[model samples]
Target: MAQTDVDSRNAQFWDELCGSGLARSLGITENTPESLQKFDHAYMGMYPYLQPYVTDEDLAGRKVMEIGLGYGTLGQLIASRGCLYHGLDIAPGPVAMMRYRLEFLGQDLGDRIRQGSALEIPWPDASFDCVYSIGCLHHTGNLPRAVAEVHRVLVPGGKAIVMLYHRHSLRQVIQIPVRYVRDRLSGRRRFASFGEAARAYYDTNAQGEAAPHTDVVSRAQVRQSLFRQFSRVRIDSQNFDTYVLLRGRIVIPRERFLNNLARVLGTDLNIVATK
Candidate 1:
């Protein structure tokens, strides 16, 4: 799709996301501390990387920016830690809802979230002490430009923690055969082999995300293409895939094998860097 077309689709997708009530789904209601703690437990369980990388020290009295405010959950987390939180999303719908939700829950975010693009962050250079974006940059019109902006907005010794889709993953492996069959049936000569077909499909398809345009890349591509402005970079894999089997209503366990498999390969690429 053309960049303009993707931009339009992304705007619509995030606009819908704002009304999705993702926070309520996590059991965080209008109640105070108790509800928030429940939500934090659920969030950390799902995305454990944030627990270690985004520590209390990183947030205390610092300027922290989250490039994508998914359900306003992270906005709450960032603000509760006493950091000046600046949230940004390409669509204004999420940005608006994020501000309202955070305030409605009795959180005091000094300034409201910003409605803007990661490709051209609407903040000045060296604007933040720490910047983090999770599962967001890959859907952008220009991934490298979005990443570069993260670097541009960080202080000299600031850090950024980012997550993107992994190119080499069980998800891609599963898609190869599926795409190979679909391609033969649809009469599209898009790949030379099933492996190539799978990569092409995974690279282009949105995979049920909130955006239409998406891309997955290897660890090296992330290190080379996205982590340039950082003085140090560390890339790792997370959300390791485990094989599963079901028969009738009873589920079969492959725990031993799946555990080992996950130890090596995960579907998400995590990058931690400092400028």
Candidate 2:
């Protein structure tokens, strides 16, 4: 398919995904202050997959923009850490939920989050101190253009942290076929809840609803993409054995063992770039 066709498909898919009311079915609320707290717990539980490049002080007083603010979980975390948080997502449902939830928390952060496209962000050049997207850029049909947009929004000396799927991972190699089989057998076209999605991921070794737009790019490709617009670049991988074990439901005695294994295997790809 042509690039424009792919981009159109992706945009349509996300619009339907949000309009399907899946977020509410997943226990996401529009006016719940405790929703943010619950989201924090879920985020911490999934930290083994996402914690490598994140730092405690990364958000302190920084003007941060998060692309694909699913559930607004990470945005809330960044806001709590004193960073000025701006979140953008293609879906309106999650944005509305995020606004209501943040307002209920007594934080006037609704304006900070907007319904926008990652491919074409609505902001001025050099507008933010940091621009970050986790599990988002890969969904764009034009990955290079998405990266360029990210670069354009960062001020001089600003930084961006982006996470993308690793094409060469053992996990991805094992899961792709499994997902094919499961999707064929289930009769349902897509997942409706995070827990259901997580269960599918573990039981069938599939990405479930997340599979449609998932792209795995090589580390070299990621480096090249970031280097085109940023002066400093670094790549790190994470979530090795622990991710597998967690999905497999294997009772491992030492949690630290998985952490060490991740350090060695480097599964999830993290790219940090400075403008």
Candidate 3:
């Protein structure tokens, strides 16, 4: 596709994803918010691996910006640590939901949450002490540009931590076959909307109905991108083992194996860059 066409399509995809009433359909109301909360906790739990290299003290009293603040879990965590938390997401639903949830938690950090794109942040240069994106930058068509924007917004000594899908991971290896079978079975003519995709994941263990996974970056590409703009850079891997047997009836005890495999396969690449 042409560059302009690709940009237009990605923009439309995110707009629909944010606009869709999928959150409501997925029963993500305030009454039953634990599901989303749990997901955030899981991601935050991985911070320890990166924490040894960076400390919470380093983040204290600093302006921190997180791109794609899904469910506001990380933002809430950041706020709890006394850091100035600014979160932006392409989806308005998540933005509103996060604001409401945070208010209920009595952490109503006003004007800290906004709806925006990572590629085009609405902030000035050197505006943040730390700029980070977790499992978000890969969705953009211009990954390098997004990294450049993150670097652009960082202060002279700022830090950034970015998470992207690792093509070499075991999860990708397992998911590809599942997606293929699902797409063949669905026989749908067009890509499912964001709401439909969420429902499919909730009802079925398949994600083939959702938007296609975009680009996958290797460790070398990740290193190149961060090193080009920042001074210090480090890359590490994380793994989460999720699988089912007998069509979701039987569960597999692969967490230990997957964790080991992550160490072996070196999937789930995280890069920390200093500006």
Candidate 4:
């Protein structure tokens, strides 16, 4: 398929299945300040490790651009930290949603949030001090090009903090095959190969719609191929089952053992790279 067609399809999918769809299902429907706080609380509860990376120490007063404004949760948080915050999303839905969110929070950054592709970031070279994206780069059709755009937008020694789906994760190594067989046997759909199955499984969101493109990467692949322009790179695996959330705390069954295991085989690859 042509890149334009893929990007169009991706935009359509996200527009229809906005990131807040699940939160809306859970009864947090409005785009009010209260609802957004609830959404962020729930989101941070699920991914407890995420907030530590986005701190005043690294982000405050710096020009930071977030590539995917998923329901404006992190976008709002980053803006609140005194940074010159900018946001971009390939789909118009997120851009509009984020605009409302920032405005509601009295941080109206008109023209700073844009609708654009990660493959072609709508920014000049060395425009930002930090470029942050989570669960966004993996959805781009050409991840290497997206990474290049990220590197281009950052000033020298700037950081790119991104999260990509891990190729050799426990979800891919075991859960995908199990679900593939079950899905095939039940006539849900027939996937041509394990790779196809994995992509389909990962792309399908809580709303049961699959994104147009999705790619998983290994740490070595990210370091060697995707981020070769960087002077430094670090990747860490972090994942916790949603079932572990009790109240706001992550209460895993075997906390130590499972967390240690997750560090090695988790699906979320949190990467920090210096350009």
Q: Which predicted model would earn the best TM-score?
A: 4
Report the lDDT tens digits of candidate 1 across residue range 147-242: 889999999999888888888876666645665787799997755566445434433322333346566888788777678668999887766533
lDDT of each: 0.70, 0.65, 0.65, 0.82
TM-score of each: 0.76, 0.73, 0.72, 0.89
- RMSD per candidate (Å) reads 5.2, 5.9, 5.5, 3.9
Clashes of 4: 0
User: Which digits, one per residue and each the tens of the lDDT, describe model 2 over residues 130-175?
Assistant: 8878777877766788888998899999988888767776556655
* Tens-place lDDT digits, model 4, residues 129-176: 999999998887888899999999999999999999988887878788
Worst 10 residues of 2 by lDDT: 199-208
**Which stretches of model 1 miss by more than 4 angstroms?**
18-41, 104-111, 179-210, 241-243, 246-260
Q: Candidate 4 has what TM-score?
A: 0.89
Instruction: Determine which window of 10 residues in candidate 3 has minimal summed lDDT.
Output: 198-207
Q: Model 3 clash pairs?
A: none
**Regions of candidate 4 where Cα sits further than 4 Å from its true position:** 190-196, 205-207, 242-258
Q: Give me the overall lDDT of model 1.
A: 0.70
